[model samples]
Target: MLQNPIGISRLVLASSSPRRRELVASLDLSLPVSVLSPDVDESVLPAWTPDETVRQLSAAKAQAALELLKGRSGAEGDELLALDAVIIAADTVVALDGEVLGKPLDEKDAAAMLMKLQGKRHEVYTGIAVLQSGNGQMHVESKKTIVTMKPFTEEKARKYAATGEPLDKAGAYGIQGLGATLVEEIEGCYFNVVGLPLSLLADMLEPYGIQAI
Candidate 1:
């Protein structure tokens, strides 16, 4: 359709996360984009497993964006989502023993998470959902990665926590930034740990429209 590298005419990102926005923009898309802040409940139910939590959260985001765009689809020059239904959303969770570790609530929490993860291996799970708007159908995929952190003492944890990098990231760490220093190894899709799981996203979106070069 468009000359953009992504061949997309319109892409609406249903997230306010800068990381997700940057990941999508890196695709060199030629379409206009709108970020809809998904203000929904992200609380996990006690019985829901880690995989279920991520899937539900991502689906919730995509559905919310689709509903938000419905009002704008009919107006003149107000095409919000692409006519092809290109909506992308994702959720990532760091899990250990089936306990999902989301963004830390505060520095204390962040430090505790880091301490628990020191010289330990854990799993990072990211759930991605892409929808085609025409028939109200979408495809979804999930990726799980194993990441091991190097041993770090309490002093290091507190110091790292002070940087504020871990405050907004799952597992109280970021694999793409300074937090990488904390990781000794990873055994899966690198992007999954970063939050988007790009390969899985591409696969899920392909049936509807997206593919990697």
Candidate 2:
């Protein structure tokens, strides 16, 4: 592989979401990409709005991952810590009429969320935080996407929930998967609803000397 001339040696994603990992890989950056699941409390305060919720969570995840990298001791850990790595962290949430709906606690909960969202328009917010390990500088931003769900019955929502795809996704649906059938249209970055907004992420990465183009 060719070296990254911009001085960023590796890209570390501080998330466990497969959707996020896949989106980052799609960028095809010249540098090596690493995945590190950040361990942090994700409880949202009752006072936090959708925008604030995701932004704080993404920043927390980035900070947790940075601390994790610094605490490692093995050969692999040492190698990773030595590189000038750029850490990408993100958090996403779905809001309907300003009520934030996160991942479902159970299949029933998933169906309920879908029922509330069907035939209605909601907003998806994704907060992205980019941290440079060498300098410890971080940039945080968020993007919003308006999504309209197709009209469907409670039974239909239940059936979709039974498929198990909605359990792990914010808004109880994954626009990139079988959940696409639930979305009638979206007014913003399509990838934002999928979990990460590629265009927004690219812009955030640019200041760190990393360009997807």
- Pick the TM-score winner: 2
Error of 2 at 40 (Å): 1.4
What TM-score fits each model?
0.89, 0.93
lDDT of each: 0.80, 0.89
Model 2 worst lDDT window (10 residues): 73-82
Q: After superposition, which runs of candidate 2 have C-alpha atoms over 4 Å from their true positions?
A: 1-6, 73-83
lDDT of 1 by residue, 41-94 (tens): 898899988888889899888888887777667655555353655788889999
Please report the TM-score between candidate 1 and the true structure: 0.89
Cα misplacement distance, residue 132 of candidate 1 (Å): 2.0
Model 2 Cα lDDT, one tens digit per residue, 1-213: 112335777888999999999899999887788789978999999999999999999999998888877666244557545347888999999999989999999999999999999999999999999888766778899999999999999999999999999999998999988999988999999999988999999888877678889
On lDDT, the leading prediction is 2
